[model samples]
Target chain A: MELPQKYSEQELVWLLKQRNEQAYSYLYDHYSGALFSIILSIVKEEELATDVLQEVFIKIWRQISLYDTTKGRLYTWMLNVARNTSIDAIRSKGVKNSRQNQELTENVYEQAGSAEMKTDAIGLRKLVHTLKDEWKILIELSYFEGYTQDEMAKMLNIPLGTVKTRLRSGLAALSKIIKP
Target chain B: MNTQEYIESGIIETYVLGMTDAIESAELEQYCREYPDIKLAVTAFEATLEQHALLNPINPPSTIKVQLFESLKDEFVHPVFMSAPTKQSAKVFDIKPFLKYIAAASIILLVISGAMNLYLYTKLSNSSAQYQAILVEKTSLQANNQLIQAKALDLFNSMQMMTDPNMLKVSMPGMPGKEKNYATIFWDTKSKDVYILPNKLPQPTLGKQYQLWAMVDGKAVDAGMIGDCAGLCKMKNIPSATMFAVTLEKKGGSSIPTITEMYLAGKVS
Candidate 1:
């Protein structure tokens, strides 16, 4: 399908604040893909991810007024909201129980299976594989899983400094693969 | 301070990943304002991370959009009725009674003139209330019209800026972890005028403000202090500038920009 006409970030934000329905529709059409991917990366379950995506858009509509452009871009703010909402969904008892019953060792991306792997996903998996296990795990937990540095440190039984260094190195390595 | 060592310290990367604690993030923003190199490193790292996130876009099922719009239908419709003038005036002016009073007054003008006057007074008060409702609606409509006109003008100006060949567009992406943060600078070199396109920057702390700097000959010249983070803002014109940057400073701006507090900058090409 053809994409909606592109709007500059400022214009899109202004239109949103004005409660323009077209802008909202455009926002959903353009951003739902990336946002759904982010939510799925964190929540793992397709059903739960769909629910979280719905909640995220509702929150965006209700709270678009609270979005201060000075603070960040619309997408960045929306991404944070999506990540937080997805994390909250995962924390619920039903999701947690299902997650535990599944393979505890499989990360969300791997559990998604190879059928879903398009060229982009293939590239991402390849880039991720190029990193050391320590770096890869850190990237997965922090970036995809939405774990904070302190949380990653505690979860991995490592010092905060190691988490920081490893995250930097991991990103630096991934940067090379993606950019090169 | 050794900026290279600081960049190598991996703090910029950590910040870009959104892993930094609040205090650490605030400190990094301060350093970015004071040092250009640190700010540049942060911007580069942020760009890389943003790229990484963009790689795995997956379209959600099409059914979701239909479901979402259906759910929001009430929200859009309900607000219109709520804000609309309640149709209470419809019951206020019962035309039968009004016509009866007028007909009765035409005959026996002397006998019932006093009673008629009393009845007319009551009718006048009722109509006044109806008139008040109409007046309020008129004012609101006027205000809405004005708002629409203003928005149209803003869009027109933005379009003009985009199409004008004399205007040089500079993309000033946010520093470090603020990769999503950005502002555009439109320089009409022929006119020597600079305009900042509305952008997202973190709101400065109380008693602090963002100042624009035009870098010429390695010296930072104060362009102006930005007042609003929204809408297009005109900044002080310079004969020429090789690069442009923004810095957080004391409320009114400082004589020289705090290099470490620099939020964004771009070289003019």
Candidate 2:
């Protein structure tokens, strides 16, 4: 069953404090698949991805008591958990280096947004596909690859200022395309 | 700033793209917190980014989700794990096993328990068999003892025929030189029978019976003969005896006792 709408994020946190199994299961249903997909994308190995997913949940459970509503929303906190956990998986194993991962991200640049995915994600991928090439590359570097502007500048052999401007310019163009 | 004024700066979009620095994010967060429109703008932008990832989402194999869920469910207490806030939280949880591990452990426990049960059953049977063997041997020994008891009872009944109702017991005391040596004879004058018990007498010198005589007024009359009853030292009923004596003599009975050979004598009193 779906989470009841009257239960605000505050009420949900209260329910979680009670250590309600229903709340935990409800939370997982909404986020586990998505978080697992993100982790598997970064970790690649199914076994390690599974491990990281469990670690993320354990962390959430242990630190839920510390969650402050004033800091930001629950979604932002959860995304941080997911991103940090995936990165931690690589570091803890000491096997996967980001430099190595960058080399293997696949020539996905050309066909990245063109996959005929069967999920509801296909529509969103189509929106990203609708963007122009020059803009899409910078977006991918900043978002998917999690590169800093200075790193992007270094990789492309451009001035840091130029990388920042193009990235800002490109995102502006893409936001327009997304809206109307 | 108007939409174009804000859009023209390209900073809001950068803030939206999350490529902004700490100062920039703080500035944006402040502006978003102050202005409802700016917060909406940020939410909309972040939502769009999330959507893009969703659109191109790499749907991992269905098996991967199942694997991830199951693995998390089963937690072995490896040192790598951090405990929950309480010890009680660490327990009271089910250990859902990985599929590969579940298969292996099931096979192992089945084999071990099966072998143990079989060994126990065999031991029980062997112990029962040994107990039954001992019981059979006990039954046979009891039967043999019963047979021996029946034979002893038969012998006792046959000896009843030798009893004399009117018999008188005569004690024969040893002579002066041989005290502690003695014999007894029972005389049934009505039946003219006598019974001798020469158990207290020492071994005779030759193959001889201790002769008995009836002496009336110092006159000797032949009564009967006595012979050793081997080591059993027992004798049965005979004809008669007025007085009895044991003496060393020849193999057969004599009508009178040799005075030098008389070992014991007694009067009918």
Give the candidate number with the greatest TM-score. Answer: 1
Question: Candidate 1: where are CA atoms >4 Å away?
Answer: A1-4, A93-126, B40-48, B51-55, B75-269
Docking level for model 2? incorrect
CAPRI tier of model 1: incorrect
Candidate 2 lDDT by residue in tens digits, A88-180: 675556444435666665643333323322223222233544567666566655654456777777666779888777777777776766662
Question: What are the per-residue Cα lDDT tens digits for candidate 1 across B99-139?
Answer: 76775775566457659767987897799788888978887
TM-score of each: 0.52, 0.41
Q: What lDDT is reached at residue B249 by model 1?
A: 98
Model 1 lDDT per residue over A29-95, tens place: 8788878887876666678888899999999998998988644456667877887787778657446
- Looking at model 2, the pairs that clash are A121-B55, A125-B55, B192-B239, B193-B238, B193-B239, B194-B238, B194-B239
Error of 2 at B170 (Å): 99
Worst 10 residues of 2 chain A by lDDT: A116-125
